[model samples]
Target: MPDTYNITLEISRYDPESHLSWVQTYQVEAGGILRFVDVFRKINDEQDPTLAWASSCEHAQCGSCGIMVNGKPLLACELLVREAVDQFNTHTFRIKPITIAPVLRDLVVDLEKAYDRVHAAKPYLMKPAPAPPEGDEYRISPETLETYVEATQCINCFCCATACISSHHHFLGPNAMMSNIVRLMDPRETEKKERMDLLYGESGVYRCHTARACSFVCPKEIDISHFLALGKEGKF
Candidate 1:
């Protein structure tokens, strides 16, 4: 039989209409490998059907299930029961929504609003360089792709934004800055001047205090601050 743990989850609950909030606790018996998403599912299945949380593509690729586990932003689908218990050295875990956006419900935040800054960065390659003479494949060398490949791995999880101390103070946060940085480093993108303007704008890289919290809690393990630092130096 797999080892089982009796875990206690103190989840933060919020009702937007009443603007009321509270903590609700649930007890669950989970196997060592069971994820926190599975634990939430079990709670909804057997204990509380009214529980509200967002999740899709439970493999940690979608970043839909980003939440705070014991005060740290993390992907719920990636945290295992045994790992949580061992890391915190406790059977009880405190669960809360990521602070990057306004909470809409129990563990659910308004992700669309959170995506505004990222959208402002214009994540696509605007002004592509003439499409490589029309007939030939627009090929990019591996060496060129390597320049900003890691930044492309960002799933827009907002975990980095939540952990960023700079985000709360009119800053565009780490991932949003990385979005612009990736485009800035891409050889195909020709709109460098516009991106530079945005990066140096009021809510841009200048607001970053280099707290490194964004790098610390990123689910993708992206060194987001490093790229932002590069942006600070105009290194692209």
Candidate 2:
């Protein structure tokens, strides 16, 4: 068996100067275990210095390397070269930036604007439940935390938002909805009613079609659509 395979990447390219977009192709030899980030690095270092993309921590914790591989949202750092080939049954891969936000350049989107909904969700505890006794800290049981812990794993990659069937203009998107749900489930938060109001508001959980595409694309494997379901049913 061969340790390396020649792969072609059809990456989306955007030019801010002319406001044009096109597909740029590059062929590189990749190891089966090499991740897509490594492939991107190889391309940038060897073939094209003009290519641009976003990446912070290469460990998949920062969620900075989010992109669409054959129209599927995924973290480039987590997808192995061979895994992509096997998943699509092709040696050529199409790479595009997530569409939830406007593209700034090649493979880079405006993440600040993309996070607007998440910011609107108010990710912090707005209202406190109550103060703990003097010299004592508030305690939350693991059993209770388990209910919403998965939602907290979201790194704001916006992959779920990109994969959502609902239009971002009308829906809060999965990560934003999950952010509110996490706060609502917390025993330390006393602003449940307000969060619930927002959840059931015009651009809220109701916009979700329960397609579960958000769950399918989440790099963290979080069941984001489940929280949307719970929110729609007023379970939390």
Candidate 3:
């Protein structure tokens, strides 16, 4: 680990009833290997017990530690404090909490709306496969698997949704489009016509204006714009 450096975090605080919001600042010393989650945990333990945040898997698999770092959406668990210092050009870094939506507490934003939007897209396998062919298991070609590989990497973190200005204003979001594309691309799945109907219908894939912000903020680095492009071309 490299030498510890002092950093400052500016968190956005919200109160639901009063519609009041404020920013709270915390100073901490972090090493090169330390992540933003580590800084929050340390602050909660030593400085402010009320400092709130969320995390799971701690390894970036859960996608629970997503937050805004210097105005961009990022996975806190995957972001190193040293990298942040270098980006901001300071031993002391400024961390801004997400403010686009209702803050559940400190770093936590209410994802229920995002989840509802995902469910609205009906992102599920609608296949009617036989009973494993009675003996042999169903197999897929490597090329087919590779086609949907990037779409499958999405962890449903809502970072894409948050970064999508069109979704933020009038549409569902890139996550839903990506999910729909994954299902559409699956070889075993039938019902492409129905899925495409849903995607191009009202409150569907056509709502996306191709802002591409979703792709930029995707923690998994999923190419969301590609899915939108395919959708626009009627290629699923």
Q: Assess each prediction's global lDDT (C-alpha) against the native.
A: 0.91, 0.90, 0.77
- Per-residue alpha-carbon lDDT of candidate 2 for residues 113-207, written as tens digits (9 for 90 to 100): 88888898899899976767774667889999889998888999989999999947899788998899889888999988789888889988889
Clash tally, candidates in order = 0, 0, 0
For residues 1-236, write the lDDT of model 3, one tens digit per residue: 36887888877766666777788888888787788899889998899888778888988787677788777778889888888888767665545545345678767877675577778777887764553666766677898888787888888777777777777655767888778877888876787887887778777778887889888888888889888788778764
Q: Which ten residues in a row have the lowest lDDT in candidate 2?
A: 129-138
Candidate 1 lDDT tens digits, 132-159:
6667667779998987898899999999
Indicate whether candidate 2 or candidate 3 has the larger TM-score. Answer: 2
Could you tell me how far off, in angstroms, the CA of residue 35 lies in candidate 2 after the best superposition?
1.1
Worst ten in a row by lDDT for model 1:
129-138
Instruction: Give the candidate order by descending TM-score.
Output: 2, 1, 3
Q: What order do you get sorting by lDDT, best first?
A: 1, 2, 3
TM for every model, in the order presented, reads: 0.96, 0.97, 0.90
